[model samples]
Each structure stands twice: as structure tokens, then as C-alpha cells.
Target chain A: MKYNVTITIALKEGMLNPEARAIQHALANLGFPTESLSTARLFKITLDATDAAAARETAGQMCERLLANPVIHNYTIEVE
Target chain B: MKYNVTITIALKEGMLNPEARAIQHALANLGFPTESLSTARLFKITLDATDAAAARETAGQMCERLLANPVIHNYTIEVE
Candidate 1:
């Protein structure tokens, strides 16, 4: 079977998001009132697996091994 | 009122995602069988907006003006 998996990787709390800061500054300058902004990386993977459970496990492994930096990031996996 | 808004920016179809390609290569090298891989940027914004509709509008504007490059990227907005 084939499953479509989505892994959303986000920075752990308290980690500085310089890109978000830059974007906030730009948005403020553009007259958009933004209180705070944070950013993350989302990965969509389509792979063949035995089942949804297998796909989720593989996706999680992928996140830990390559998709996300465990020290500074956390990830969530969704299978469809 | 304070609203939490998320803006997901992704490369439009036909655009090359070198980063995804690199990740895919690394995954394959690691023995993970991946059919296809894609990546996107996800922005989480907390801001003051009159309503959900207003927040969505502001988030969309942010995507258009800065968060995404219209020529090569597309974005989706969610407000909570």
C-alpha cells in the first residue's frame, strides 16, 4: 500500500526565529499589525508502506533521522 | 481580539525544490524508500484581528507581500 505522509517540523519554544523577526519587521513596515510570528518547515512524503501505522512509523523515523533537528526542532506526522 | 494564524507557503508545481531533492537523496542513501518528497514553509502568527475573516485577510496579504514569492510559490492561510 501507498500512504501520503506529512511531517511538520517546528522550532522548540524559546528558540529565536530570526526569519520570523525579519518578516514581522517587514510586515510592520508594510502597515500590517502583527503581534508575533513563527515559522516552521513542512515536508510531504509519498511512500509505499504496509499500512498507515507502518507509514507513520517510517515518517517519524525520517523526521528523527533527517527531516528535523531533534535538539532545536520537534515534528508531527500525519498519514493519509 | 488575538488570533492565531498560520500561513503555509509552498513552491508552485513545476518549480524545482533543490532542498527536497537533497533530502530525498539523503533519505534514499539511508535506505528509506521514498517515492516522492516535497517541502513547504509554515508560518505561525499570533496577532490582533477583529475577526477570523479579518485575520485570514491579513495573513493572505502577508503571504502575497512577503512570505511567498508569487512567481514561484503559493500559500494557504488558516486562522484560529
Candidate 2:
């Protein structure tokens, strides 16, 4: 089954500034660098996953790993 | 100015079941009725608002007036 997953990740209040810096560091470590991106709190992602369960699992993983900081960030995932 | 506004309203926990009924009632009151819809906690909305501020304000109004329960439901609005 194909599952459409929409994951929204946002920096918690007072975290956008630092989170953008961290995101930049992470990207540069991965050999890509960019500048002048919005330090907005919200990011929206749309993707197709293998199945509903897997999609949820993967979305959770993505948020924990890269999209959110367990300390100051939270996320919500919707699978349809 | 043209603003793209996306408003998402979902039933909060323990509210979806009743909210759908309320939504149906509201719709019927507005001269439309339907059945066989999902009482899911997540909704996705896309529209164009007048501007960033207006988009945010309208999104909040839609949620408070129709999309969410002030008691049980909470929402986040993102304007891009």
C-alpha cells in the first residue's frame, strides 16, 4: 500500500534562531552549504511512504533525527 | 497583496467523533449535509489569504469558528 505522509516540523518558541544554525552545521557536515534561508519555525514535507505504519515510523524517525530537537522542538505527522 | 493561506482543523482527542456530528449539523444548517467522512485528527487546508498577517488571522478565525474546539482542539497556522 502507498501512504501519503505529510510531516510538519517546527522549532519551538525561542528556538528558531539556534535551530537554523544547527541545521546549517548539519548540512555543511554533510558537504552542502547554503545561506540566507528563512529561520522560520515551520517546515512542511510531503512524501510517499511504503505503508501507513511504515510512514508513521519513518516520519517519527526523521523528526527525531533531523527535523526536531528532542529538547526544544516538536512535530506532528499526518498520514493519509 | 495575495496571500496563500492553508488552514488545517482537526478534532482533538476525544472530540473527533462528536465534532464530525457537529460539522454535519453545521453544514446542514448551512444547507449541505454529507455522511461517510473520516473523523481523523488531522486536516490539510490550502487557500490564498490577503497577506501574511491576514492569512494568519483568518486561519485562526476559521479554526475558532468552525475547525477546532476551543476546549479540546488546538492548531498551528503557518503562512508562506
Candidate 3:
């Protein structure tokens, strides 16, 4: 079967995120004051897998291996 | 109330996505062949707003004015 997967990767807490800070700064300047802001990368992949579990497992591997940096990133996976 | 909002920005159809292609190539070289792959940017913003509706409105405005290009990229907003 073909699986559509979405993986959202974000920096772990306490990590410095200059991009998010810059965005927050811009928002504040635009009158949309934000208490805090963070950024993440979301990857949508289409691939062939045997089943939902298989897709989930492969997706997890992808995150560990490439999509995310394990030391400073955490990721969530959704298979549909 | 303090609202947590997430905005996901993706390339519109027919838009050239070289980054996605490069990642897809890497994934293929890693033995996880994908039918296709795409990427998006997700912004998680925590800000003060009157209500959920107010928060949604502000987030939508943010995308229209800054977060999304509105020409080649489309964005979805989630407020929680």
C-alpha cells in the first residue's frame, strides 16, 4: 500500500532558535505581539509500505537517520 | 487568553521545489525509496488573544502579511 506520512520536527526545549525569535520580532513590529514563538520543519512523504505499522516504523527510522538531528530535535509522525 | 497557534506553509502545486527533490534523492540513496516527498515550514507561536476566534484571525493575518508568500506558498493555521 501507499502511505502518506507527515513528520514534524522541532528543536528540543532550551535550544536557541534565532529564526523563531526573528519571526516573533517581526510579528511584534507588525502589532501582533507574541509571548513566544518557535519553528519546525514538516515533511510530507509518499511511499510504499506493507501496512500502517510498517509505514510508522520506516517513518521513525527516517526521522532518526535524516529528517531530524537526534541530539537537539524531537519529531512527531502521522501516517494516513 | 494565551493561544498556541501553529502555521504550516507549503509550496503550491506546480511550484519548483528543489529542496524537496534533494531530500527525496537522499532518501532514495539511503534505501528508503519514496514515491514523492515535500516539505513545509511550521511556526508555533504563543501569544495573548481574547479568544480562539481572535487568535485565529490574527494568525491568518500573520500568514497573509508575512509568514506566507501567498503566491507560491499556501498556509494552514491551527489554534489550540
- Candidate No. with top TM-score: 3
Q: For residues B15-46, what per-residue lDDT tens digits would candidate 3 score against the true structure?
A: 99999999999888898999989999999889
The chain A TM-scores for the candidates, taken one by one, are 0.96, 0.51, 0.94
DockQ of every predicted complex = 0.88, 0.02, 0.88
Flag regions of model 2 displaced more than 4 Å.
A13-50, B1-80
TM-scores for all predictions: 0.95, 0.33, 0.96
iRMS per model, in Å, is 0.9, 16.7, 0.8
* lDDT against true structure, model 3: 0.93
In candidate 3, the residue pairs with backbone N, CA or C atoms under 3 Å apart (3 or more residues apart, or in different chains) clash, namely none
Model 2 chain B poorest ten-residue lDDT run: B35-44
Backbone N/Cα/C clashes per model:
0, 2, 0
Instruction: Give the per-residue lDDT of model 1 (tens digit) for A1-80.
Output: 98999999998999998988898999999989788888889999999999999999999889888888999998899999
List where candidate 1 sits over 4 angstroms from the true fold. none
Tens-place lDDT digits, model 1, residues B10-71: 99999999999999999999889899999999989999988999899988888888778999
lDDT of 3 by residue, A42-77 (tens): 999999999999999999999998889999999999
CA shift of B78, model 2, Å:
9.5
Winner of 1 and 3 under lDDT:
3
lDDT of 2 by residue, A41-72 (tens): 33233434557787688667755755467787
Model 2 chain A lowest lDDT segment of ten:
A36-45
Model 3: per-residue Cα lDDT at residue A55:
96
Candidate rank order under lDDT: 3, 1, 2
The per-candidate TM-score of the B chain, in the order shown, comes to 0.95, 0.49, 0.95
Top-down TM-score ranking: 3, 1, 2
Tens-digit lDDT track of model 2 for B5-61: 444444455554654466446544553333322233332334355577865775576
